[model samples]
Target chain A: MSEIHALSAGLALDASVIGGKAHGLVALMRLGLPVPPGFVIPTAACRVFLETGGLPGGELAGAVRELEAVTGRRFGDPARPLLVSVRSGAAVSMPGMMDTLLNVSSTGDLRAAVREVFASWTAPRAVTYRELHDIPHDQGTAVVVQAMVLGDRDDHSGSGVAFSRDPSTGERRPYGDVLFRSQGDAVVSGTVPTLPLDALATREPAVWVGLMDALDRVERHFRDVCHVEFTVESGRLWLLQVRPGGLSGRAAVRVAVDLVDEGLIDRATAVRRITPGHLRAAAVPRIRAAAPPLPSPDPASQDSATWDRAGSGSAMQAFPGSDPPSTGSSRPVTEVGSAASSGLEILARGRGAGPGVATGRVAVTADGAVRMAAAGPVILVRPHTSPLDLHGLAAAAGIVTTTGGLTSHAAVVARSMGKPAVVGATGLTVRTHDVVVNGRSIPDGAAADADADADADHMATDGHSTSEGTTGNDQTATDGRSTPEGTTGNNQTATDGRTTLGITATDTDQVVMDGWSIPEGTVITIDGTGGEIVLGVAETAAGDTGPHVDRLLRWAAEESVA
Target chain B: MTDLTVLHTLRCMGFTDLGRVASAAGLAPEEAESRLIDLAVEGLVTRVPGAFGGWGLTEAGKAEDARLAAEELDKAGARAAVTSAYTDFMVLNPELLDLSTAWHLRTVDGVAAVNDHTDAAYDARVLARFADLDRRVSPVCAALTAALPRFGSYRRRLSAALARGDLAETTESYHNVWFQLHEDLLVTLGIPR
Candidate 1:
């Protein structure tokens, strides 16, 4: 029971003993997909360690010997060292709440790492997470000590997150982020910018083919959509983690309907997959998305150096002459009426923490956001956030920050406060009232310069509110103030008479945060769910769900008999 | 020196009515008003006249509070201890927000629906966890109190909020008080928002 077991398809063990993560790995190996050879020190051992504060010792040595024999590597040898990552996983998933130590080689390192993982189940954060989620605190997590297969081993090596279907729209395509020449932690940390997942096809064809086959097998096995974390080492692909069917809302409907269409699952099962909650979430309004315009030839953008970096998809998309985004929620070859011909340009992309859209003038500093918000809707854009920025965040229509992940302070606060936010746009830089993204600066102030003074005066007098921000290009003086509502449209016209794209606010139920250098007074729309910040009211927001979503709705209606 | 009690109370509470400021400061309305008036006269405070009117710190007032708080921190020589306590509070910060969010929205079967608080057992569970969290938070509060006496008010306020049994739906609820305390620590330590 306390003895570590080798991870293989044949070794049947309860999740309580080996944990869900190791169980998933075993299933992947069973499906004839690649998983690294490793061993699991069981949850029973964790209970023992927690009680006595030490491992049984000899069992771990035996497990290491088995791993060494399987992988043909020496542990702690300077010439041909074998490394392991010690992680804590429970019967139920407790993602990222506990500690993990990677690249442990020495015996001391291994013991310390294992001890840390065992102890980490009771980490205050983990305890708090359990308290919120109603997971029992007493269940000690199983420790997974496995051989470290390097993701950053070579040019052909990288790590990625892949969904069997698009998570955003539930379309039948693999979608997620990929980081070349980086480890799994880099992708999780979100500190390193990641390329789109499709880059794998061109970079490593064999790995891509292997991944697709694995995705198909896993989906067929689970009879639903699945997501996996994978790493490739020197052209060899390996699956690290797998989970099935966490799709939600409209995406949930689309998946259920599509799976039925693909004959992977029956219609009754599709109906069962949806609950009343899915219907309600599907009803939430979204920002209509349009493909952002390629950046016009700016000298800095013309330089190949920026796009030369391996799979800089965002940067490549920024160039107007370059190819449209082939991956992500943005359509490559499949979707229709989603393309941008109206000259709307995307300045940056980040994690959408909040689920609605809003548009406003970009305010770089908290003081600026606080002051500027009085005049018009202001999107507070910062490098990162601190408690000092609360007043500014409170005042702003939406929030955008250059750094921090979905769980970062800015993201957490924004979601709790119910403001649409996009965080962790790595290349974003703010200067005064304008934001520069990927070396292509969106001079927000410059576009509004013609009327900056007047707008500032209007803001000071009228006090922009939610009601005032949503008035279309024509509505005026609703707040009983002389602030000109009709004048904002003037910023949309350039000297050449080609319409300069700017975000325009309209009365709608969706939440959008726009900081993409639209003219300060120009209204814009955003889809917080899709992490899309676009200029102008996206014409395609809610009125169009297409044939796929419509079929789901019809099927759901038939199923509920409600 | 400067009325640190009233100023710091307003600082933590955001824009609010005189009643909350007075109650939070452990003072009567009249006493709180007098202090606010004095602070207003010194250009450290201002009142907005509207349907949602309240007295709030002006730019000058916020600066003065920051300056006074920093000076007070140094004067008490409790910087290190207060910082240590702040670290502990930070570890509890996300959990605090999680509880608050759960109180507002229930994630059922992978969907987030507004929590009606109709389920007595669920509410009880949330409140019990809040109590557990409070027990863990007590030492952090005590450490802050050891460093700065002014921080003792937060301990009292938090305990009182818990006694009142507010999980959600109150501006001065336990969650809100804890939020303010979190903000106060950040502001007191001259940390960013």
Candidate 2:
């Protein structure tokens, strides 16, 4: 039986038997990647247990004995006891669709613990998810039980997640988040602000090296962008889960072509992998250059900092000239006073949906969002939004929610509002008073200024893809709200005209033609697909089909070595 | 309850002016106006002084209403019953929200695109979902009425609002009685909005 297979290097378990996550982990292990030791109880056992009105007597007891024998520890023992994470994994990927309990002290209560995990497959939220995703309801979940590697075990211990490749730009580099002394859920939860995966080098060199090598091997084996959830315990690394084919848009196109060029997969498979939906998603507009010009205050009476932070431009792209430091170990430059602010941190990198970063002050509460309409632009932050938050929904510049799936209240509302949003940031526990991102605790009051910096960076970098801020002389002042520092980078289209005082920007900021100055009163067209700030509301372009995206498609058209 | 006090309840009910809140509270307009004046002194309620304006709660009035409503639920010893009803309400809350979202926006090919209102069939499907949710919510309304007689008014107002396509009253539609029910639940539970 699939249940009897040891979750080791060569266990012949199907997705149906071990669930998708454990199956993928086993695949990685087979491919010689670093995966933690774990075993999966097949969905059949779950079915039998539920049918018989509790766990079958011998199966669970036998498994527990085996676990004790293998790990050389008893469950829930005070002295050197073993703890495990029990999670539900369906044959299909039903992310967050079932219950997951972390840090369960495995003991005589192991059966009860397993039952709890199994029962979660039927929660209202999970049921709704299945209904929307078209997954069958009767198909139960397989349980993956693994020895808990405490990410918070010591200073040297922490948690992180990594993609075998940059899922955003389809760059051939490992990308993810790393938090020292945290748990696997900690990284997924967004409870602690996470450093870039590269930070692992400075923090834990051996772990970082192992991770990078493992990532490389996994990428080669999967021949596609793969993501791994992992944790480190007292300097030792452990892999929790793995998956492939979770990319979309430009990144997807790029990977398809690049894999063929690397002789991994052939062009036909690449073509087959990309659907029309992928093409459509890729063409969504984004902010062109990081750091766009700020608008003049309507009244000087407004809190300068609130307005400064609240300014729509605060979420602008990163300035074009900035480059991501090459070393994996560069520490964050703590800008004076910036340490207190909750500026933007790149959480989990994904293919930029629609581009063009615009930042506004973070609005934590629904009431705060409604009151913000008259004040300035605001980004709505919530544990998850409900219908009651409609007034705030109507007024937000963007949306960031800590919980729910992709089709959640926050995501739907953000799409309706035509705002940039990131959802399913599991670890974000934002209250009316404070918010958490990447494990960093940020007071609500400090979030405003940080929002401004984020906006400036967002406008400049276009989703942190390029560190280079605003580029060269192509800058054309849009509304004559120009800053003296506006240096245009290569091939930039800036709307800023230097009619005002002190402002500075690095060279290479792109400056484009003044199509029509989008003044405060002048309602201009914003193409979420093209990242274009245009003259008037125009018909949606058939498609931009930009050269950058086209190059990716061209590569996908080639033959694969695999 | 005092006649004047019942009249003032109509004032906060809005639009139908003094009569609606008064009738719902089982009072007369003159009596309600007298109570409204007393409330006005406290700056709890106000008159709009226009053809469109009638009686409405000021910020303080809204707070007072919430406090008083919660006290009423507690004093009646119906807090447990109301709380149970509220839990049931929470279950149906998202379906209502989803219907509202679908009404405002349309999803095509898994990507939620703006609902330009081009597709009649899609709109119908969403409305059907709203209808389904409303049916589900009826039981909660009945339970609330069972807990407290005053809550009976919500059932009438909500159904009337839905029948009239008042939009807000239906689910997420503006006239949505659901919003009022939500407000009432919060007030009953002593939970802040």
Candidate 3:
């Protein structure tokens, strides 16, 4: 059998042979999506090269000749040279573990690039990744040699990765980041800030429409949420890669249920797709709108309003403005609370680096965090964290950074400590003794004094601010919320001045929004699951599966009974 | 000449105790304390009086350390070598961070959970990768050491951290030492953080 196979609809090879990337390209071609013409050197060829340290003599040359004939361009010709990108595609994804060479226009360079990619499979980092992920080492990666589509070809050109749905919220909206007049590498490098994918719609409407159509078709074919990497050359859209099913937790559950409603999948498939881990992740306490005094007559309209309110909290919120939920049949799985209804204002929003909800007083410095933690839970806020902040991070209940992304040092450490973290709050400013968020300069140390006063006052009134009382309240809240009679139990708990979970009357009384400065001991709630930072303790529904999860679980039970 | 070794070490390590400064600078705790006191008299460093506080550089100490680092580099005529090494270090830096993150969080059933270090095989796999990365970083370390002798301590400190299984979380962990080295490179090159 030939070692090289043309990437086409008719290519009949297992992913284990051609690698997942090439197989996806084959699927794209089969679906009639525009993909750059390419030939794949299967894993067999890579194995042979690894053993012999040389390419098979005439096979590569012959493939290149066929490619040249098809494209009407020569490999090394100066005018209109056939530039190509050589990429590594393993059966199991080992992201960022191998190398890719782009813009290769010469035979010699192509050969050398192929060799480097093959050798990279055995690179120490890649090997370690494989071992950690339990991917077999002996199965080599296929080399995908594709005709390069220049994203930098003109002012109308660009590259980006688009998700069929919002990966974070699992809202059925096309979402992603795009870089104009730059290659795909720049988008992934994150050195340059990217425009939201919707920008492509206004700038290159034709490409945008084509991309939207392609996304819809791929989602239908895969029967799940799909992500595509694409480049538009002078306004023509060409998909470079396609991947399905990377959504997790709440997003995954939402997508599964939505897919069932769309008739692309059945109830059984939807229930089967959601694992127990997804349920646990979905149950992680999220910042939701406090239950409305009266349920809205129309839940669907209320759902959209809730989405707008929740999205408005983030400066980088990338929802499709003015678009209703994609599926009318799908209900809101997680209802977010509005500021007016919840009686809590969002101070700032960021990327959720860790998962869970934490309520604490703000501590601007690491030292302050340690000192304040002796009295109450503290949230360590920083411009960016370093090794020096390790102790502060350890001591804090949660972490917030004014700068840095999800993978920053602060984020990594916070996750290690199992603390909820929010990073990349661009509107936040860290001063010497305080933090400024959304034009409000909050004093750090003054809150500590205020908390002491509140404690003294609380002792005089109810004696519930003590450590033992707080623990008892927490235990009652946890047990109450787990019972079928949770709503009544929670209402009763809230009626008592000091028995609400993570909140006390003294805490709420001090939550006054005075001219700019929120004292250091003023309570705030952060939802690391949704990246929402709310002033004062916001109500959290820890185990509420919501309407979507409830409907899916019901279907699962019915399917089992049948 | 004032021995700026202890001062620079403190600058790179951030606010740390005398014991950490001594261990990182390859000096005895008493010797490190003596130098810190001398620097404190000059208002280059200060000791915060609290449970969380320790010996740390003041603004003056930070400026002095930067100046001294620049002068040391020029005197050794090692700026070019150090810069080249820094370039190489940047390539490995992300990979190291990725490894550290992998050590802390592992995906189970597609949800990332804190690694409890219960899975012995998984821990062994991650540790083996750290060892592999350490091997690859040796050349970069050698190049930096050739440029400045103080950099030789990093090679020893990193290996010791790995040997002690202090991959992350701890003050003396491999990740912490690597972070200091990154800061040292930026300071030595007179680059902004």
- Which number leads on DockQ? 1
Give the chain B TM-score achieved by candidate 3.
Answer: 0.98
Backbone clash total for model 2 is 103
Best model per TM-score: 3
DockQ of 1: 0.33
After superposing candidate 1 on the true structure, give the runs of residues whose Cα lies further than 4 Å from its correct spot.
A51-54, A124-128, A131-139, A152-157, A190-193, A202-206, A234-236, A289-431, A435-520, A527-532, A539-562, B1-3, B6-23, B27-70, B168-171, B190-193
Candidate 3 C-alpha error for residue A175, in Å: 1.9
Candidate 3 global TM-score: 0.77
Q: TM-scores across all candidates?
A: 0.75, 0.66, 0.77
DockQ of 3: 0.21
Question: What local lDDT does model 2 show for residue A466?
Answer: 34
Q: Count the backbone clashes (under 3 Å) in each candidate.
A: 20, 103, 3
Question: Which stretches of model 3 miss by more than 4 angstroms?
Answer: A290-351, A359-383, A388-397, A401-407, A424-526, A530-537, A559-562, B28-30, B74-91, B138-147, B191-193
Instruction: Flag the better candidate by TM-score, 1 or 2.
Output: 1
Task: Compute the lDDT of residue B122 as modeled in candidate 1.
Answer: 79
Sliding window of 10 residues with minimal summed lDDT for model 2 chain A: A307-316
- Model 2, B80-119: lDDT tens digits are 9999999998877765655554565443443334456688
Top lDDT hit: 3
Better of 2 and 3 by TM-score: 3
Worst 10 residues of 3 chain A by lDDT: A322-331
